[model samples]
Target: MTTRRLTLRQPVMDDAERIALYLNNFAVAGNLARVPYPYHLADARAWLRTWRPDKPAGETGFAIDLGGEGFIGQVGYHLDARGETVIGYWLAQPFWNRGIMSEAVAAAINWYFRVTAAPKIRSGVFHFNKASLAIQNKLGFIETGAGNLLCLARGEQVRHIDTELERSVWAERQDA
Candidate 1:
């Protein structure tokens, strides 16, 4: 899938270095639930190797790429522990505030809804991650409830605001 400034493509081994470099930053990884602090190339390699073309949309993701920059970030969804389809994304710090993440996530989610029969996409942000929550809100996601999710970087549970975007709602937004 392609966006105005990004190409949502599959991640490659060559991207492992870039993924590790960006994800190593606490400012980026701290907000995420699964990424550990001081992220390493091995982690990126392992994560990259997990991707398979045959996997369902919920188990696969897109590598966000720019024309000049090879890999800037990632966008996709996965099944949570409870077996719900959940969308997630992260962009390099240098690309922050550029609307790049928002664009990439939008494209990914759009494609996800089109290709699957999922009723809605589940997601949320750590309480302190207001910027990420804003992106979800802009994409038609609404607060579902609250919970605690473990942040590997923080080494503890953090307050999370759960949200969801129904397929019907997404369809309405697209029509508008």
Candidate 2:
């Protein structure tokens, strides 16, 4: 899927270098639940090898490619252990505060809702990640709860604020 400033495409081997370059930064990896800090090219390669377009809905990902830049980040969703499909994303630190992630996430969510009958897309952020949480709020997500989540990069559980966006709400926002 294409946005005005991005091309959301399936990840490939060639993207490993860029992915690692961005994710290796502690600032980028610290907020994510799964990514380990000091992320390596090998880790990116292994992750890329797992991408499959045909995966069940809510279990797939897209490589976020900027217009001039190549792979800069990722936006996608996954089914949690509790059987909820929660959206997650991370952009290169250099691209922060530019509304790039907000746009990419909005487009990805639209595509996700289009392909599945899921009622809502769930998401959240670490308590201190106000920027990320703001992006979620901008896209119509609302706080649902709070708890602690394991951040692999941090190697510890951190306070988390849960959020959710319903399809109807997104549809209304799109029409606006």
User: What is candidate 2's lDDT per residue for 25-92, written digit by digit as tens?
Assistant: 99999999999988999999999899887887689888999888888999988998989999999999
Candidate 2 CA-lDDT value: 0.93
Off by over 4 Å in 1: none
RMSD of each: 0.7, 0.8
Error of 2 at 61 (Å): 1.0
lDDT of 1: 0.92
Error of 1 at 98 (Å): 0.8
* Candidate 1, pairs of clashing residues: none
Query: Poorest 10 consecutive residues of model 2 by lDDT?
Result: 52-61
Q: What are the lDDT figures for the candidates, one per model? A: 0.92, 0.93
> What are the per-residue Cα lDDT tens digits for candidate 1 across 1-176?
77788899888898999999999999999999999998999999999998888889888899999889889899878998899999999999998998988899889888998899999999999999999999999999999999999999999999999999999999999999
Query: Which has the greatest TM-score?
Result: 1
